[model samples]
Target: MMNILNKILKRYGDIYHPHKQVMESLKINKYLYIVLILIVIEGLLGQYMLYLNKDIWGIIFLLFYGMTIAIGSIFHFKYVEKKFGSLEEFDLEKMNKFVKLVDQEVKIDLTNKEQNQIINQMILEKLERENIKEQKKRAFTGGIFTVLLIPILLPFIIENNQDILILTVIIMLVGIAIIFFSFKSILKDYSLKYKLERISDMLKEILIFSLRDKSL
Candidate 1:
């Protein structure tokens, strides 16, 4: 059986490719746990402050706290999106080169029917899987921000407390659940990472082969 750290490392590569080592070095796993704890602490503070002085300092704290989470969450989502977007482009470039190679080879002499069909199927499957993975990543990021902000914002900006607290609790639960579920999914399946590594290897092979042939 794979050790827990090995499993986490595998998932890390899946979620983050080029920056996998950087993020891991930063101990993102520990950072996330700290962030979650801070969030819960902030929520409790908000609830407590609701009963205390509604003074300027209290209001400022509330404003700053909310802004911290809201702004930070937005930046986090954008960062992840940008990273994934780059990887997606890298994968597409590899695929485009593969297609160009096929076209060129066909112009010289068509590939065997079985080889062509197999390559086509592999490309299609890879593209399909990458698309699904991207969608999931986007959804997870958006869901987290929406869940964290909507409930907390409603309580602060409006006058009603009855439904807001209940909603806040619900949203908190949902956000935590989503994070946990996403982590599980990443650790359980390395399909995205596997495909990425495969593409990188293919690109390297093609470059080496082209260089050798040129030398000949």
Candidate 2:
């Protein structure tokens, strides 16, 4: 029993850690949580209104609430990113610091070629790890949204109106498609292999400059 519980905890921890790290790094975890709560409240309120047979008003309210939250969250994210710098910039600074510290401790007798290779390897490893974390995070988010959509659309499915059911199905499909394509785009643009290669190239250039400076 204890072993089973431990395994469960470990599995979930692995799944959750990537997103937690991202939210914390961006310093928007609390804000995002609040937005999530507001969204849930909005959904519940809309559902209640619909149950009360105020379909038009409920939809109008939902649209208004959703738009407000979406716009507010976008602005909030922008402000936070502006204030703290983007996650990419933060990660780059972390890598730079790590490289600087390693360089300081490195023996002066080490050849420039050797040092360059070591730094390149380190950057690649770090970026690759980050890439894995990002992929995991995106997968987790997609899974969550998929699950949430089920309950959100359940009422429409149960309704006797064939037209409403068809519309619901179409909307759900569209939502799923958006999520799918978004994930694909992220994978293409934010691939760990690509980022690692880019970082490696940039680091190599910097290292070359540093070697020249040292020789002068």
Candidate 3:
């Protein structure tokens, strides 16, 4: 009974997961920096084009810019998924190698409680990262469609007052839909984060046991 309970608890334990903080800090700062720079450049260009006799093409470019930003923001999930998957696969291989080494009777008496605890923590943290990445991918898909619909419908509504009114309503509806989908995406991310965290601790515990019992 105790063994079963420990197994369950380990699956839910992510007592020291720094990867979450690390991922968020790096992702936010890197993307924000690029976006800020782009916004500045966009502003300067917009002003210059405005001075050039209210260049219609300038407005078009601004629309394009907005669309691109939205698309790019969501598209980042692909890169994140690919990069994180590779890292996770590498880590898994390392884990397997370490386990095999232990099974081959490398060393036996080095295993203990403290080392197990640390391993559990590491595994849980990694699990959380993977879950978050998956959620991001899912969210990005929904986000892309929400963003694309706006630009597609925008051009058609600029024809007359009735069209303008209809466009305004459609835009409002799209905005609402985006907000709804975003919340759903965020919820998925949060749920996955929690699950991965728990699993990570359990895996880490297993790794620790294998690493310490190298002599089988």
lDDT of 1 by residue, 63-100 (tens): 76787678656655555457557545545444454446
By TM-score rank, best first, the candidates go 2, 3, 1
Q: Which candidate's lDDT is highest?
A: 2
Clashing pairs in 3: 105-215, 106-214, 107-214, 107-215, 119-204, 123-200, 124-200, 124-201, 128-196
Best by TM-score: 2
Clashes of each: 0, 0, 9
CA shift at 103, candidate 2, in angstroms? 12
Model 2 Cα RMSD, 1 decimal: 13.3
- By TM-score, the better pick of 1 and 3 is 3
Candidates sorted by lDDT, descending order? Answer: 2, 3, 1
- What's the lDDT for residue 147 in model 1? 74
User: What's the C-alpha lDDT at position 22 in model 1?
Assistant: 44
Model 3: lDDT to the true structure: 0.57
Candidate 3 ranges with C-alpha deviation above 4 Å:
1-128, 131-147, 195-216
lDDT score of model 2?
Answer: 0.62
Taking all chains together, the TM-score of candidate 3 against the true structure is: 0.32
Q: Which stretches of candidate 2 lie over 4 Å from their true place?
A: 1-18, 25-33, 85-88, 91-216
Candidate 1 clashes between residue pairs 3 or more apart in a chain or in different chains: none
* Per-model CA lDDT versus the true structure: 0.55, 0.62, 0.57
| Of 1 and 2, the candidate ranking higher by lDDT | 2
